[model samples]
Target: MPLTFTPHPFHPADMPPVTLITDETDDVELARAAHRSANPARGRIAVDPTPATLTSAFLARDILAALGRTAYAPTRAPVITAAPAWRAVACWFIVDGIRELTVLRAHLLTPERAEQLSVLRELTGIRLILLAAPSSATQAARLGTCLAETGLTDGLLRLTADDARAFFTRSLPTTTPLCPTFPLSAAPVSSQPGAARSQYRAGQLAACTWLARHRRATGQVPAQRDLELFLSRLTCLSPDPATTLARIRGAQGGFTAEGLRLSVPHALATAQGPGLSTLPFTARTAHHISRAVPGPPQLAALASLLFTGAHLDRLVQARVDDIDPDGRFLALPQPESAEFDHHNPPPPAWYAVPPSARPFLRAARMFRQLEQVPGHFHLFSKSFGYRLEALVKDAGHLIPALSHLHPGPAWHHQARLTHR
Candidate 1:
């Protein structure tokens, strides 16, 4: 059933006559004009208070005409409303009663709408009224036409700069004045002279060295999980087991054999040097090795093997002051752990240094001086593993015939025995 609005009381004197203005052909403008000219104070222009029912164009026009007549005569204005969606009637009503219109959400009005409003006022001889809300260029252009000529206010006018300052001063005495601030530019980067090397992080270095040593001793690399377990056995390792395992994985270079993994392309290798069958290396090969041997850690590593044929562990733990200047000897230290006690101990306390190793020892001493390596206690820190690999790399760069001369622990041990 269609919903119908029924009056509560059906008494004659109790209710005012409700005129249902359904006839669109009625000359509403003439009737309103006659009513206005006859007796403006006596006649009341009844507007349908419910805007929802005022959906048709004819209804909007009748309401606007009634409002116009009431506005022109000596009388107070009655409230008449039009919906935003019904464009033709809304445009007509707005242009006609622009000075009297009050809208909600007027900022949502589009440029096309503002343009339409301009065209509407021009064709309908209606004066447009604008409010403070829609202040875009399009809205302003439409408003400028009526406002400039009619000298009408756009609802509320903006305050002058001086007036605004005075108003704030009077209203807020202790409030902080706002000021704009700009950010400073960033610093310039410094330049480096040589070709940039791939950054092998410090964390990965120790794990790589440990893995290489393992592969050398057992002739097989351990699996990733096994490597993690091995690193866990070392003291002063990362407290987080997961982080240590991650570092080991990062150090590995993706080579696997017999379900075990090896991190090749590392700074060092464990390839054995030919013992009695050692051949002379070319000057070019020696030059390449010299250049490839990176920094003091690698230099110290190479020097330990070539000079006194000291073991890797003893070379690492040996102190700077352990070297005798006049005697040309490196004082090897005891093993940090007795786990390797069954293996041969270092040659002696003061192992003789070869003449060929003198230059490298001098270079190591100079590097120590340059770096200001402190404490005559330990020659290299735990981070020494970072450079140990580079020494192996230098040996690897040798010419094919001289390649077998790559210094391994066994070769150094043999050299030490031969010297003695």
Candidate 2:
């Protein structure tokens, strides 16, 4: 089968046109003058915050309100307001009504980090409503009260549930064309001791042979850099040079081992690191690999992470201690860590994934893949725990059965582990 690649459907190019928020009759000149004075600095100059800064904040809030009304539905947009000196007050109102607000803590407040936190807040708000409704009507009411108290009555920037549903249901053109036919199966690797070595050799040789043929067919000769990289990975995986060469020369496929290696030269080199030398493949290296052979375990794992909103870095770095054993879930702080204190830490609860995610079993399998890799099992376990946490946080209805599925040390250590 020919290789097929599909990119994400949502791209910057696909976004709607920007809507300007200028008004000739309004205080445009005043806002501009204020902005200039507040940010009067070129290359290395210091900029001072003055009345102009406050005016600029007002302008931004106004623009945001307009954008919310035009770009988002009533239930899905944020409640934007031009409160030049009222942001703190608004925040207090939200906190007072909701009884709490999550704040994330980190070492530095970088611009990128701030942006990420803002996005997380928006996502958390939507998720909270979805997950806490019906069974937690009181919580929903408190959320509504908080919004109302925070001067969100304008309703222009805030979104409602109906608006969110509409957005997800909207149709858009596909970015990546689906493959016509997927290569679903391949022969299993031989496990016989003496035969194992020869089998591996044959596989490697087959890959190299296929790579040569593929290069010839595509008329795109493999690069020397790529060949070296492929050879390097092969050597790392198979200490026995003869077997490595044999497998490269023996495989039969549209894309040869050498050609495939050449196609992803950088990846092949990276995958050859001491840590990955013995592994069959690296997670990053398997994307294209699976396209040539659909339904592979690697593909499934990737799919799961993508669809579940799990952060790859977080998953890779997670430790067993992060899991709440009693809850069998991952605990993600809201408003997030900046909003919480470490000395007197807030109670971290577990989040459970809903059963609906079962459809993406392939993606879930990636956790298993991580587990199989030496030194990564703890990280994988933490990721699994987190996935469960997200499920509980996002699930509309709580299923008691899943509560006990994860029996990690955290659960056993807790005195109230069995309380519903």
Candidate 3:
């Protein structure tokens, strides 16, 4: 079967034009089409309608799976099996950065089920494509009516099998590379504050000794220029502790393996070093935050809480100026009472934003700047209440720490002060 699509078929908007494709083929063709069309990286999801049930919930389940949402944990199962799957599905679409959805076998869906898909489009702003069999004129007409009512009738393009095949083959946002996924796992590399530091110290001594010994034995002392460059590289501070360490280890291995008769010990090469390889945030927390947090502001806030273990009070006190220009460092000042304004405010404590959290922080900062908030205004105070609370409510379902609060403050904040 041949397929085709427009050269420029996508619009970067929430309510972009929708597409409808009609064709008849063997089951094999349908299977092939579904497989080839699904592009999770581009947020392009292709879901074949369920044969047994054509309900919205089933549709949501298919979309969720296509979007790569898995309910591996018993707690996570509710995300897919919830009473109204649409709500969960909608949240995940935004969180996962979904841009388009394609449903196969559109001709078999009932008007009600089709309407539900329409609602999903409105909620998620994903471009929708429906592929159906042209078995009968009556079915085509019925599908047309469904599309019209649901406002699914936008940028309608008619293409043959060659056109469809080309459409799926060409380069589009749908074919773009995907962002790195940070799955939930054990606590970050630094279980204790000193572990990484100690490891780095141990590795540093080994690396220096090995380099000196190799230079003495091989009479391969570095020239002044080369020594300066090597020193600069060896001491540079990397953004991530783990990644930098990996790069250093890899570099050492390459140097030794490159016919240099010189090689650092495996332990030295693999040891944790002061590099951009820090994992302040837990992998599990990072995974849930991306799927559970609704917006960038919440994403940044929840990430801070998860990594810093700080209360909302500190987050609320954050100033737009608290974050660095690169969105890498955040300085959290103490909350000042309305009653007193110090002549000279104390300097705030600074924290490094993990690589995953930095993007959200940068986005949130830009969002505030677009709204033209004064530099001194609270960065998260405006979003601190329910907006942030909802973050916990949804993410809490999957995050063990926040699961008990019913979407409120962290455990420590639950304590109350009794009034007279």
Best TM-score among the predictions, by candidate number? 3
Q: Give per-residue CA lDDT, model 2, range 16-72, as digits (tens).
A: 221112122233342233222221011011111222332334322322222111211
- Measured over all alpha carbons after superposition, the RMSD of each candidate to the real structure, in angstroms, is 36.5, 22.4, 14.3
TM-score of 1: 0.25
Q: What shift in Å separates residue 207 of candidate 1 from its native position after superposition?
A: 44
- What's the CA RMSD of model 2 in angstroms? 22.4
How far does residue 39 in candidate 3 sit from its true spot (Å)?
A: 2.4
Q: After superposition, how far is residue 30 of candidate 3 from its true place, in Å?
A: 3.5
Ranking 2 against 3 by TM-score, winner: 3
Error of 1 at 19 (Å): 99
- Who is ahead in lDDT, 1 or 3? 3
* Candidate 3, 266-363: lDDT as tens digits: 44322321232122454444655566443445557766665444445666788878887566667666444454369756445445565656656665
Report the C-alpha displacement of residue 203, candidate 3, in angstroms.
20
TM-score, every prediction: 0.25, 0.24, 0.47
Per-residue lDDT over 1-420 for candidate 1, one digit per residue giving the tens place of the 0 to 100 score: 111111121233322221111112333342332233321122222232223332333243433344332111211211222321122233223222332222112223344444443333332323232222344667545544534343233232443333433432343323222222334432211112221111113334554566577778886545433442232222112222233233334444222212334432222224322111122222332333443333333444554554333345556777756665332556556542354453765433444444444444544543343334553756443324654453455445422212334433322222110000
- Model 3 earns a TM-score of 0.47
lDDT of 1 at 98: 33
Worst 10 residues of 3 by lDDT: 1-10
